[model samples]
Target chain A: MTVIEDALFDLAEHLDHPGGEELEATVLRRINEPAPFDASPRSRVRTWLAVAAVVVVIAGALVAIAPARRAIADWLGIGAVEVRRVDRPLPNGPSTHTVPGSLGPTSPAVDEGLQIATAQRRVRFTIAVPRDPTAGTRSGVEVDSRTPGGLVVLRYPRFTLVEIASQGDVPVVGKLVAPGEHVDPATVGGAPGFWVAGAHQVTYLDRSGRVRTDTVRRSGPVLVWVAGGVTYRIEGLDRVTAARIAASVH
Target chain B: MHTMDRRSDAELVSGARQGDLDAFAVLVGRYRVSALRVAYGIAGSEAEDAVQDAFVKAFRKLEGFRTDAAFRPWLFTIVANESRNRRRSSSRRTKLDLQVRDQPQSAGAAVDDLVAQRDQRRRLLDVVASLPDRYREVVALRYFAGLSESETAAALSCPSGTAKSRLSRALNMLRAQLGEEVTL
Candidate 1:
C-alpha cells in the first residue's frame, strides 16, 4: 500500500465497531418471521377479490364522471404539493402502523429528560424551543452529541415534540409523510413548512442507507420545517396547532 | 464452528440460498464488522440500520446471486447503493471522524510518537471527510474495506478502468488535501 492508503487504514482503525449479540438476534428474528404482506392462500384469494371489486367500482366511477379522471391526474402531479381527497373514511384501528421501512435502532440516547439549558450545553449547536406557553410544558430534552453537528430532541410529553438539528447533522431519507398520509403546505412563523395531517408512516435510512425498522410507529399529525439553518420536526398536534407551535419556536 | 469459519463466503452463500439460516448467520457474523465499517464510512449514524437492511435484502434476493461471483463485492454493492440512496433522500452528507478514545495509549517516547500518529490520523480523516461524495466512497471501498481494484469496480457497478481512474483521482485529491503533511 502507498503512504496515503496506509494512513487511511490507520485512521479507519479508530472507528468504533460497537458489535453486539443483540444485533445478530434481531436480524435472525426478522428473517424468520413471515413477511408482513404474506397471507394464507384463501386469504390471498379473498384479498385479490376485494381488490378487484374496489378496482371495478373505481373504474365505473371514472367512466361515469370525467372530473374524477382530472382529479386523479392532478393528484399524481410531481410538484411540491399534490392533493388527493378520499371519499370514504380512513381505516380505524391502531393509529400507528409499522410500514416496511419504518423500523431501525433508536438514535444514540443522550441524557434524557434534561432541562433545556443543560441539553443545549451538551450539544455544539444552539437549541431552539417553542416560545408559546400554550405550546405546552417542556417535559424533556435529549441530545445526541456523538456527531459534530449534534441532534437535540425536545419533548412536551403528550402535547408535542420537536426535533432540532443542523441541516446536515442527520441523514433523513425517504418520505417525511408516508403514502396514504395527507400533506399540505403551510407557514411556520412565516417560514414555509409542510403540514402532514393524520397518522403517517415515516421511513428513515440507517447510516448505511438501509431502511430502519426499529423506530416506533408514530401516531397523529406533524409539521416539518427548516429555519435558521436548522431542520425542525414538530409532532403530536393537529395541522393548525402544529404550525402554530412551530411558529413559536425561537 | 471452525469448519463454518473455514467455509468460503460462496459456500455459505449457496447454503443461505437454500434456506439454511445457520449458513446465513455465519456469513452475517463474519462480515458484520466489515459491513458496519463500510456503512459508517458511507452512511454515518445510519450504519446499524443500513447494515441490517442490507443483510435482510441480501437474504431475500439470494436466489439472484450468481454462484461464481465473489460475495463480498456483491454485498458491498448493496451496502453502497443503500448508502447512496440514503444520501440522496436525506440530502445530508456526513464525514466520518476518527475518535481518540478508540486508540491505544503509550508511555515515554512512545507516547510522543503515538500522539503524533493520532494527530496525523485525525488530519487524514478530516481531509477524507472533506472530499466530495464520489471520491470519498471510492476511497472508503478501496482502502477502508480493502477491496481489490476489480472487486471495487464490481461493487461500484462500474468498469474496471473507471474504478482505477476514480481511485487515482480520489488518491490525488486526498494528496492535494493533505499537502506536505504526509508523503503519498
Candidate 2:
C-alpha cells in the first residue's frame, strides 16, 4: 500500500457524520463515573457527622470576633443594630459615618484574602473554598440562588439546609445581611433576605461545614444575608474577586 | 449590551471556578464536538474516552484558563494530550495500513462501489495510527487540528523543519502502504 497526500477534511462532516450519538451520553456518563458521595449508608451518616466537626471551630471563631464594626462609609448606611467600639476598626479602613462593615457577608467570595487597617484595628481573612469543578459532588443540593435562573436541579432523593448562627463575631465566610432585610421581596433564611446579584457565585463552608454561595452586584449598595444553609451575598467579597464572579454570571 | 450580556470572560471563569457546573457546562458545550472530533481523529475508536479525559481535566483546571486566549485551542491541546495518553496505555496496535496492494485489478467496479471506496480514508487513518508517536503527533496536529506548519511545530514543541519532515515522511509511508491507491 502507498501513502495518500490529502488528509480528511471531514471534521465538520464527520462530526455530523454521526458514528454513534449514544456515545455522547455514554461518554458523559462514563466521564463523571459518579462515585457515591457516601459509599454506604454508614459513610453517608459519617459525612453528616462531620458537619458537626466545624461546630467547635465555628464557636471558637465567633467567640474571639466582634459582632459588627460600625465606623461608617459614604455609600452604605448603618442600621439600628448596636455596635461595639473595638480597637480593630472596620476592614479595609475605618468606615466614617455611612455603612457598617464586617469581615464581609459570608460567601465563597472570601477566597481572596483581605486586609483592612485603621488607627484602631486591622481585620484579615482568607477565602478557602475548594474550586474543583469536575467533581460536581456535594452531599446535598447544589443550588444557584444568585440568580432566579441560576438554579441547578439536583436529582438526589433528599436535600436539606441547616443554619447554625454563632452569637457574636465569627468572621464567617458568608453574606452579611441585617437580621431582617430584603433586597427585593424574597423570604430567605426565615429572616428577610438580601441576595447577592452578580456574575460570580462565591462559595464558603459555614461553621457547620455546609457550603455557602455568594455573589456581589453593584447596582445598589450590596446587601448581605444568609438563607437556606447557603449565604446570600453581594459586594461582600473583595472587589477583584466579586468583579471576577459577577462578570461570569449569565 | 444589557448587564447580563456585558459580563466578562473573567467572570465566567470565576463562576465556573466556584462549582457553578452550569457555567462550566456552558464552557464545555462551546468546545464539545470540535474537541471530540480532534480527539476522535487522533484517538480513533477511543475518541470518546479521550474527549472525556480532556473535558474533565479542562473543567478541573479551569481556574488557570486566562480569559484573553481562545479557549478552543487550549481545549484541543488537552484533548490531544489525552488522546496520546490513551493510545499509549491501551497498547492496541492493529497494523492496519492501506490494503490496496492486495486488491484484484478487476477494473469493472460499479459506481457506488467506486465512490464508497474508503481505501483512502482508511489508509490515512491507518498510517497516522501506525507512525512513530512523534511523527504521528505532527500529522494529527496538521490535519486533525488543521494547524499551519508553524502552528503544528509549536503544538508539537518541535522546530518547523522537524515538523515538516515528520509530516512529509508520514504521508510517504501512507502512500507506500496504499501502493496504487496513493493519491499523490
Candidate 3:
C-alpha cells in the first residue's frame, strides 16, 4: 500500500465518528415527530402485521407451526426463517462457517490457549462459562475480530460449540435450521431459547444484500438462548444436557 | 429489544416504510457514522445538516427503497446527494477539519512521534480536502467511509467503472499535491 493510502486507511479506522446513541435519539425524535401527512392504509396494514409477528415471537407465543413460518418469512422477507431437516448426523471434524453478506466471513480457529478468565477480560460483555465442565471433554475459545460486537466461540471436544454475543439484534450465522431439522422454542435458565435439531445450511447476505449459501453446515442438536444481555448457543448436546450446562453458567 | 436489534436491514426498512420509528432508529444508529463521513467529505461545514436532511428524506421515501438491495449504499447515495445540494445552495467551500480529540498515548509511543504523526495527518487531510469535487467524493466514500468500489459507485449514483476511474484520478491528484512527502 502507498503511504497516502495507508494514511487514509489509518484515518478511516481511527477517525472518531459520532456516537450512536446521540444520532439515534436525534433521528428517532425527528422521525417520531408529527408529520404533515399520514401513512397509507397499505403501509399501516404491513406495519401492523410486522409488529404483531415480532411481538408474538418475543413473547414466545409462536410455535414452529407451518403457518407461522409463512408469516415470519413474509414479515422478515430476506431475513426469513428457514428450516431444513437432514437424515444423517453432522461430521465429527472441524468445519468452516461463513456469515452471509456484510457480517463478513466466519473463522473456525479455536484459541486453545485462552483461559476463560482471560477471555472474560478481553470481551466487552459478560462471559458465561459452563460451570460443569464435562469430564474428559476438552474446550477452547475463539474470538472473531472482524465483527463489530466481537463474536466469541466456546468449543468443546467432539465439535460441540457455544457461540455468544451481546448484540441481541443481529441474527446468528447460518440458516435458522438445516434440512430435516426442527426448531423448538424453549427456555434456558428462565430465558428464551431454541432447540435446533439436525444439520442446517447457513446463509449469508453479501454487501449487496444478496443471499449467499455458506459451504459449511452445522449438524447435531443445538440449543440457543439469550439472557442478561448476552446470546449464547450450545451445540452438540441434548435438550436436558444443554439446559443443565446453560443453567450452570457463571 | 428484540424488535430493535435482531431484525435485518430489509426487515427494518420494511418496518420503517410502515412508519415504525423504532425500526428507523435502528437504521439510523447503524449507519450514522458512515453517513456523517460521506456528508462531511462533500459538505464540510454543513455535514451535520446534510446527514439530518438525508435521513429525514430517506425516512419519508422509505417506500421507494428496494428491500433486496443493500441499505448502506442506498442511504449513502442520499447522504451524498444531500451534501451536494447543500454545497450548491450555500456556494461556499469549507475546509475539512481533520483535528481529532487527543486519545491517551499508547504504551510505547513517545510524545514527539505522536506530534509528528498528527502533523502528517493534518497535511494529508488538507491535501485531500483540496481535491476537486468528483475526486474528493470518491476518496471520501472509498477511504473515509470504507466503501468498496461498487458501493462507492452506488453512493455516487455512477457506474462502477466511473467510480474506479474517479478514485484513481483522485489518488493521483493527492500524490501530485503531496509530492514526495506522501507516497501513493
Write candidate 1's Cα lDDT for A1-250 as tens digits.
7888877776666765444556666677666542312111223233222211111111110111212212222323311322333354323344243332222233333456678788778666578878888876777676655333555767675454544443332233223233455567666666555666666444332222233323325446666766665556776777667767777788
Worst 10 residues of 1 chain B by lDDT: B93-102
Candidate whose lDDT is highest: 3
- Is 1 or 2 the stronger prediction by TM-score? 1
Chain A TM-score of each candidate structure, as shown = 0.54, 0.20, 0.55
What is the C-alpha lDDT profile of model 2 across B19-86, one tens digit per residue?
55555555555545556656655666676677776776676456567767655556667878898888
Worst 10 residues of 3 chain B by lDDT: B93-102
What lDDT, from 0 to 1, does candidate 2 have?
0.40
Between candidates 2 and 3, which one is better according to DockQ?
A: 3
Q: lDDT for model 3, please.
A: 0.61
Q: Candidate 3 residues A16-97, lDDT tens each?
A: 4444447667666555432211222234234233222111221111212222223334445533444333343333345554
Interface RMSD of 3: 6.3
**Residue B16 alpha-carbon offset, candidate 2, angstroms:** 4.5
Q: Which tens-of-lDDT digit does each residue in A120-185 have in candidate 2? A: 021121111223242233343222222111222121122111222211222223322222222343
| Candidate closest to the true structure, highest DockQ | 1
| Candidate 1 CAPRI-style tier | acceptable
